[model samples]
Target: MCFKHDRAVGPLIEFFPRYCIMPAQIISGSETAKAIREEIAAEVARLKTAHGLVPGLVTILVGEDPASQSYVAAKNKTAHALGIHSEQVTLPAATSEAELLGIVADYNRNPAIHGILVQLPLPRHIDEAKVLFAIDPDKDVDGFHPVNVGKMMLGERCFLPCTPHGILELLQRSGTETSGAEVVVVGRSNIVGKPIANLMLQKRAGGNATVTICHTRTRDMAFHTRRADILIVAAGVAKMIKGDQIKEGAVIIDVGVNRIGQTESGKALLAGDVDFDSVVGKAGAITPVPGGVGPMTITMLMKNTLQAAKQAAGIE
Candidate 1:
């Protein structure tokens, strides 16, 4: 059941109707993230000029995993391009948990490094929690430190997790009124779903939305999704949410990036939890798989690093 709303976003928006097929506006995360990065760059320049402080981000990669290496490289490249000092610390897969903790401790006490990010999926032998706990909360731009998490839970000033914060930015920038809206998140990972749900529930801008989190044990997933005014899917299963599963004119945010298969030439391709083609007409607005949540994640990391730098420099 599609309802008509005054959405005058013609230049960069589309509205889907019930009787016929019309694509909803495609929320371009790439475009949003780029705009944000540019803004952050300007701020970085100002910080250097007025306060003589350069925001520095040090990303610690614990293994030679190809995907992790690529992600860390992309983050470092973006940080430098935005005028933030970036460093990469690579540790062999066999590095012990204690050794990694020592490195984290060194950076924690180093005033030059504002943000310390330990890339996820650390080696099985390493205690990831111990390493995260070792980083000073002020330098924990990844928002994994217990202190930061506690502050966030209490609605205090704190660095937010990148992926979830990115999702919040997308909703706010895209003109989605999260307050009082019915939001359904289809995952429970600490990274995306849990944080997003907590964020949306907060009584803040782009928050206060009635949210429901569904997981594998959900008896009827489609029932909850169909009721959402804003649906955020991070189930990690490619193309899990189909067209008919969503309500007409619902806004969809896809956070899961899974490689379903390959192209005809055997090149790798990615897909999202929400079926893009199928949900195109069903949703009021939706994000594309690759260009959706991916860009925003890194951009938010930059924002966190900038904030950390401000804190370090004693500049509110």
Candidate 2:
């Protein structure tokens, strides 16, 4: 059921009773992330001029996994383009957990490297947790360190997990008010779901929303989703949330990137968790799959690296 406007969004509607279909405004993460990168570039230039410090980032990849290599390469490219000193360390699949930990320790003590990121999905023999825990919290720009997680929970100053922070940036940059909004996040992954939910519940500019997280255990998913003013879907399933499942004008942020098929030329066709075509006409605003949350993740990691550099130089 549609409701008439109670707030001053614009002039009153002149439509017939009971229904109106307005297409959702597309929230382009590519555009937003580009704008942010420009801003980071300027700050990087200034940091060099005044403080004579170059923000440095180092990414460690454990294996030759094609997808991981692609992601790491993209990150290195972006960091270089943004004027941040970037390095990528590649190791064989047979590299032991202890060796990886030792490498992390070397960077942790190296003042030249402000941010250290270990590309995930280490070899089966390597203990991923041990490697992650070995990096110093200050240099843990991926924000997966236990110390950083604890600080985030307390609302203290720390590097936030990249994807979650990116989602917040997308919402705030799009001028979506969250102070009293009803936000329903679908997923429970430590990477996206848990952190994003906590961020929206904090008492801050991009936070203070009433957040409800739905997981596999959720009895009535539609019941919670239909009531959300802002719906963030990261369940990892392809086109899981359909049009009729959402409220009339809810803002949708799709974090899932599933390859449902391939195009004629062999390019992969991607879709978000929220079915874009099904939800477009009813949603107030929505993000597209491949271009939505995907671009912002690495950008936020760059942001964290810059912040880490500033902190190391004692420059706020």
Candidate 3:
């Protein structure tokens, strides 16, 4: 099957093309996140020596969902690698909402704990809203607390949702000028789309961009996308956006990670929302699925945890 789309434009931006002989700049999320982690590590060392403080992250995991368990483990491992104090609280699948809230309450008052993260999609019996709000705003490293969310919208210094904050770092660090640029975000989930769009509209570096959000109900997705200087596709549908929908020279960030199926030998395979092969030729800098945005999310969580630690220690 041919991957090329009929729609044509100016010279190709040649972004990160996967398994293709192309000249695009592959934005390596691992590289970007590694650099940021190094900086965080240095800061961690400074905090320890100067103030005898080690930033701490507490993860609350409920049930045995394989994917969630793996994610929490990765976060725990990364926190320790960076010298951040890490704790994992695993509860049975049948744990009550009150019990979980009680755990949050305990961590909130604990001086040693700076960041509290509750792995999402809690058991059906738990009231997620109650549990989310139960976390002290300063310790809500996931940025899901109402206080942090409101503060972010108002352009205050608060923990940003990890994925979106990481995406912003990718753009700024990669030298993509967001100021006055036309940006189109393809998803509207509170996690990725809404927060990213709000970040773009902010008066900050990697922000101040004109943003348009396209979701399932939106008409003319391609038309909006083709006008973007920066195109972010977070729609969960696998390879949903094709090359024909992209604008040449547009920077593509693939935030969607979906399991398409098994590979030829039965290994699990993953794909992004954009048809990367088709869009790769046209993008300026593209983030490859699995290697791109995925790594940055955890790195940003570390950033948030460090910040939370700073706030608690009264470190300006």
Candidate 4:
């Protein structure tokens, strides 16, 4: 039985009969995200009433990629729902790099727009690095700016990359202990892996863990994985980690979201890096694919935007 953290429960042992295996506790990202959104909504209300400040977020989409369009739309809708001044700029595929940079500059200078996010995977002609560098670090709520990245490395107070930040939130809210724990992250991507590894090693409330990151070249992936007290898998492959690779009672945070196949009605079937069925039985707590880290990523972006707005208005 996948026990949700929010529901009332008696003794944990009572739910499992003698000789029967107990399923991993389900760390519901959807429920956690909802609770965080409520907190943010309350804070937004207070910020408006006390200081007359409303958070503002602007998301820029360079092309007509279906996935990017949908992601940007969801962000705008969430911003509006939270009483933020949300703006969506949809440019043609042929939009010049110079023109895009100019738009970012405009938002950077505009005091009303506290957060600016440029959707990733720009068109072939555009230099992705140059576009990211053009964004003012203070307004880069997506936390992709070099300045923000550097500050994050130094453990300074800067907007963290949303997905990694969300992972930390999940660990924190789920009551998973990180201090001195063995954390093995199975990817080195900048967005998720590197940042998360850095976060896990930092001397903070959600950190102070011994972290090891595995990548494509790792010779013995299972060896390292088996040693982990908490395993974080972000490799894009579907169901890569199996039951035998993890330590017993390890906390599993699966970050991979792959479209494996479609359902009978034509909906996409999603899967994570860690094989859910095989690992769920051994894990002490685990996050499910669809309702896991995905929702928390957008929620953290909203959090960063709110923080940016507060900083701009000189309101702590």
Candidate 5:
């Protein structure tokens, strides 16, 4: 029952020393999404009246990954619904790195466009890191650029990554108490795992939580997960964690988006890292996959776009 390192032992002992199931709230994203849209619409209206121009979000899609295409399409549709102008630049799968970088540069310089996001998981032939670095930090609404990442790490003011930021929003809107809680983030990716951990452990709002991050190499993942008051799974595995793995009453945030085998009709189904049906009864709170973290991601993008606009226009 002891971890090798004292840093690990300290938190493990101080928090999650006992396992007990707590009452959970299953938050559907529809209500959250509707409220977010209304808030963003109000913000947009205020910005337009104050600055005389609306914020614009430009998304660059290089290839035709069905999932990525659908995501971008949804983003565009959501932007319009929220009264934010959206522009998408679609390029062939064969588009070179230079071509993609050039497009990002154009968006960076365009005064009318306040935010620029390059759809992720670029073709294998392209260097995603190089392409991401080329985007100006001011216009990097996706917050993947190293500059923004560093800023977030240092606890400085900067654009937070969409998914992590969305997770914070979800927890906040749900009235979850982050301070003094034991939060286990089950991923190490810069996008969700690291950023979220940083956010939860910060000294400000949504911070002050003790955080532990587990990954493929981590020993006894369940041991750590069951101890967490707030369990965030982003491992990209389908139903990898089961209800028995979590303590009763633990708050679960499923960030995984995995497409499993087709149904009897040959249509694929989506699932989260946690087994929803199994965990629902035991968890005090849990987020469903398709409607949970997914929708919040795009909503955060809209927020970042509006922030980028205000920053670029010196409107605070």
Candidate 6:
């Protein structure tokens, strides 16, 4: 069956199997973001009232990349809204490697700092892997530390990267089944690609999905995507996959964040890897950029922070 959301010019058609037609929640990004913030706020209040513990997050931004600044700002705003203590350490683009390491060391030793995230795409001068390694694994909210990554790979309970965890939460909360399904993840970046692929293949609840990972090096991406029961695209390209590339009744999870110029206004707008207009008519369900994966990332970050706080307090 097809679902249409009418617009001024025409109806936006989306298809799903007839049995799957129970009015699916739109999963509004704004609404979910607000609810997650409120939930974290309540949890923080409870923790403080019972244990006098306040969750703390520290973010280090090395350069003034516009996108990085905006992302850090949003993180700060959300932390405050949730009554969690947060601090941002801004450094010059030319800051020395030793200086960055020193900042991480300080946060590492600070008992109050429950979580730490060094913003991505650090200045070209600094070694990104070295900085990530310097973060104490316990406080690595971004989950980029080798320790956490290793733990995840080994199927141990640990803080997971926000984006991947968010995608999992989105699928679960939406009532999508993953067990034993054919899941194709397009992209192999350590952050969103590899970790997610590992998570899906784990032998656990909400996992055990047969996963295929595709990358630029893959011979035929469309062939893999077309057969996916759940297709996750994180290739960092704009509308790289069209409707015909996906199979009917497949669930599409877009992890790419691309800025493309608008045709009419010539201004830039955000888009995902999958062509939403085209694939919506073929996929069983699809996540829209700006709303789908973005909000979940922040929510999962809060969750990791809360977990860290609990660990620090010996409550978990």
Per-candidate clash tally: 0, 0, 1, 0, 8, 0
Name the candidate, 2 or 5, with the larger TM-score value: 2
User: Considering TM-score, which of the candidate structures 1 and 4 is the better prediction for this target?
Assistant: 4
Cα lDDT tens digits for candidate 2, 46-72: 999998999999999988999899999
Compared to the true structure, candidate 4 yields what TM-score? 0.94
Distance from true location, Cα of 255 in model 1, Å: 0.2
For model 1, state the Cα shift of residue 203 in Å: 1.5
TM-score, candidate number 2: 0.95
**Evaluated with TM-score, which candidate comes out highest?**
2
Cα misplacement distance, residue 67 of candidate 2 (Å): 0.9
lDDT of 5 by residue, 1-316 (tens): 4343266566765575454233358876657877988999999999878778799999999889998999999999999988898999999999998889888888888998988889989999999999999989998889899999999888888889999998888888998888999999999998899899989998763678999999999999999999999999999999999988998889999999898877999877889999998999789899987889888889989999999888888887
Error (Å) of candidate 6 at residue 270 is 1.4
Candidate 2 segments exceeding 4 Å error: 1-14, 17-19
How far is each candidate from the true structure, as Cα RMSD in Å?
Answer: 3.7, 2.7, 5.2, 3.5, 7.5, 5.1
Per-candidate TM equals 0.94, 0.95, 0.92, 0.94, 0.90, 0.90
* Arranged by TM-score, best first: 2, 4, 1, 3, 5, 6
Question: In candidate 6, how many Å is residue 58 off?
Answer: 0.8
Span of 10 residues, lowest total lDDT, candidate 3: 9-18
Model 6 whole-model lDDT (C-alpha atoms): 0.86
Per-residue lDDT of model 4, residues 64-146, tens digit only: 99999989999998888888889989999999999999999999899899999999889999999899899889898988889
lDDT of 6 at 113: 96
Error of 4 at 41 (Å): 0.7
